[model samples]
Target: MSVTAGMESGPPIGVTAGPASDRGEIHNWTDLFYFFNHSLPECHVELSESTKRVALFVLYLAIFVVGLVENLLVICVNWRGSGRAGLLRLYVLNMAIADLGIVLSLPVWMLEVTLDYTWLWGSFSCRFTHYFYFANMYSSIFFLVCLSIDRYVTLTSASPSWQRHQHRVRRAVCAGVWVLAATIPLPEVVHIQLMESPEPMCLFLPPFETYSTWAMAVTLSTTILGFLLPFPLITVFNVLTAWRLKRAGRPESRRHCLLVCAYIAVFVVCWLPYHVSLLLLSLHGTHIYLHCYLTHLLYFFYDVVDCFSMLHCVLNPIFYNFLSPNFRDRLLSAVVHYLPKAQPRAGRRASSSSSSTQHSIIITKEGTELTAAGPHHPSLHFQAPNPSPISAPGSLTAS
Candidate 1:
């Protein structure tokens, strides 16, 4: 039988057996329930060797690339466009930036996971990684909520004061959001410790005994703030906006309201299950057989949900680049400049020549003097060969 125990903080916490051979530490490959103390089901781990590595690489990289490119584009487009600097886009820009910060930490996690969940990076990175992960998550959620609120305000209010001092509103919203996001990592800094798992995992200190309480609290808070609270507000505001649009008989408003409503709905549906699973996994007696089964199912599904939800960062750029007219035009212009030969304009040669010819017309009108120039001319010679002191509508030389 292989030895099983939590080794001191170093390497991976694997079993070290001797004599015949070393099986290493027995990792709890079973679901959360098994880890908690539930009846052990047959190890149902499904990630294959190659798949795990590829997935780790792809998920982190996609998050980094998509979020970075999209947010950067958002900033550039907004900067160039007359799109008024409002709280909504400001929050969006900051949110995107925060996501980039989180994405920057992903390569570290990716490397650690690929190396069998052992953090090769030291505790400094561990803490920082955990810090930014939560920070980005909170900022994204807060910004989404702020966006919904901004839309609601635009739809609901019509006061002059609201319109006149909108910049102050945006500033306050951004400041508050930044403050909230920056505080989310306090728990991570408090609870994380260097621990030896069968896989040399760096986990929350005190194992489930202490980690469970903190994890549950943090996850529950994140769930409530990130999904639950925002979902209802978004739904209610969108519904009200829709009702008003219908009453006002504006088709465009109705369409916009419906689209935003759908976005909020999808966000809630995708993230809710994952948060619920996290909350349940932290509860006492979660290691029981039933809990283990549920936890495993949820854990697997959580990853799937996250993979889909990560599309949020990807869609941000699309929303700015494709949905927003200003952003779309700028992107198109930039792309055209970058690859001018990719799309040739039809009849461009003829149109350009005609335009140049039409632009050369010069007309001069004076008392009893009229002159006209052709569509193309180097210069117009205006000369009265016969000195005519008589100023009348004589046969003027049409140059």
Candidate 2:
């Protein structure tokens, strides 16, 4: 529906309950949904909306700027050396896109939250924003799983046939993951409708019975698929690799697992609370709706955790850039090629085929070091050749 036309006071078709409720207590728990979190936590206390607006705007703006810059830098660096990139780069590029897409949806959310959860964007945007949010959030999780699986398979398998098919298999799996994540949110988009709570609020209007059952199923499945299963598998692979490396008597530190550990840390720190809180709230949402005073804290906690989880996008680029020496080198290379002042040297470097050797100079807070090997090599405090002198035990380098 058109933005203006969608505001023509559509039917308050769904179940509603409780006195003076902006979100009426539905008699049953049928409206729980995976993507449609359009309801505002009805504040029982006198919380200042202005205060919330200021806090939200600060976070939204900070995340927008930081996530945009970090994601773009990683993507540009990857594509610049796109020709030489392997499956890992491909996955990283996809992850960046997924994270970026999710974070971009926040400005819309910020607008709605600022208005005390009244949605002004009408029907299509209401659905589209939720759709985009879930699509990318799920995609990021799936891509992370894909990366962990890639590492596991590569490390454990030794057969030539497995090696031969690895590239093709990786490409196919990655393609399937994106397509699947993109398709999963269609039902949420279709079910979302706008209703007036004095002002229009976008809501998921799935038949109440369908929500109590299938919607709950969707939420549980997300918890298991998005976090419970993949995260453990990723951890397992890292542990196995560490064990094998130690058995081989290699000097590589267990910190090599740090990249995967950082991934785990982001998921746990950013997402774990959101999922757990969402589950608790979904189960008791009906009770809370009836006894609004009793469960105000639950509602408040859910919104806070859910909103904070968006920071994963901002953190992902920082983790990859700082943790992976390769990412830093590519970023430096991209800056030289694209920045105005570095153009002269970049042009000279590109034109001379005979001078293919590249020197990667990394200046850290503590010192400066140079790394030489091909166009890209490890850099930062972790600079110097492989087996970096500065690398600590448990420190891992990107392949």
Candidate 3:
């Protein structure tokens, strides 16, 4: 019942072809050379079914464990009163929540993959799992977009009236994001079904008459909404923010610019290949007859890139929270607060002294002050960084 068990007897997964009569003939020497060069290696370079199962299980399990722990820490550190007040912090917290949601769905997926794509769970579970996973996927990326925009606005806008109304604006934006994310996955809930023929499997199957059209539509929609639109916006805003900081001539602006570039690079490295594969597969589905070798390559390519895309859940916290000195300070304080009383007083004193030596000032362009305290003074205190409404960038705030 393995999904790949009968691959030689049928078309590859996620690919559909026209009839044999419509298949193109290699009528020239050039076509033959192209096939030998491009398609021959794919025939020999494939992993065994057992190898793929074990590799994917281990990969997803690691993502589940690490993503769960780190995202939970982010939520705990940011759930405190002071962390709840800022637009940037709010976006970070919500993004962590969305990443956690995706992590929670991994166990079920791991189980299904281990069972060779079997759907032991009923139809309702199938629909719900797909819905939950896609919703969080959309929301997580949308929050990153919001974070980029907020960083740009923080650097550019300094009006007192805007600051007064930011809380309402933040709430409205978060709510709208959640609403759109929830709505986008309705198709999954409606179209994903638990198939019982040949063997029980979960798949997206529409009416036979409209299968190709539906498949192409879904692929295009996901690519456009998930990557095509949001990525450009994220890049533009982050680049502009970095450029503005560089122009301000702050000592830390170079480092801030580098961090901004890192954000953009990671997003592209993780997502671009996956969306590209989706688009290529959709094109092949439109009754276009790709060579057998190219079809196989596309199938394998999709699998690899899809797994790579899930890595963002693991990387998000590191780039967005763990990189920040303030977040690290908060995490350490939280850990020390929960330690047992039997711990050595000498060790605690050592920690206090070490923390006292580490000091940094973070001044937002809007004049908001953020102070990270020593171990003895565990609470963070916020105030105005400068009397002037606009000031130079002081420290890079990790998104």
Query: Model 3, 136-246: lDDT tens per residue?
Result: 889899988887776667667777766677667877898999999999878645866666654566566556446556666777778888888999888888888778778
Which candidate would rank higher by lDDT, 1 or 3? 3
Off by over 4 Å in 2: 1-49, 85-87, 209-211, 258-260, 285-294, 341-399
TM-scores of the models, in the order given:
0.67, 0.72, 0.79
lDDT of 2 by residue, 1-399 (tens): 011111112212121222325445444323322112345334446555456557866787788888888788777776665456343556667788898887777777666656666677777787777777778887887776776556545555667786567668867887898888878777545766675544676665566545545445555666776678767875675566556556656565455545556666776888777666555544554334435553445443344556677888888777645466655665666666665442223323444454333445544333233221111000000000001111112223332
lDDT of 1 by residue, 337-393 (tens): 455243333444563564222232233222122211100000000000000000111
Runs of candidate 3 with Cα error greater than 4 angstroms are 1-14, 19-46, 81-85, 285-289, 342-392
Cα RMSD, model 2: 11.1
Candidate 3: TM-score?
0.79
Model 3 scores a C-alpha lDDT of 0.63
lDDT comparison, 2 vs 3, better candidate: 3
Q: After superposition, how far is residue 279 of candidate 3 from its true place, in Å?
A: 1.2
RMSD of model 1 against the true structure: 20.5
* lDDT scores in order: 0.47, 0.55, 0.63
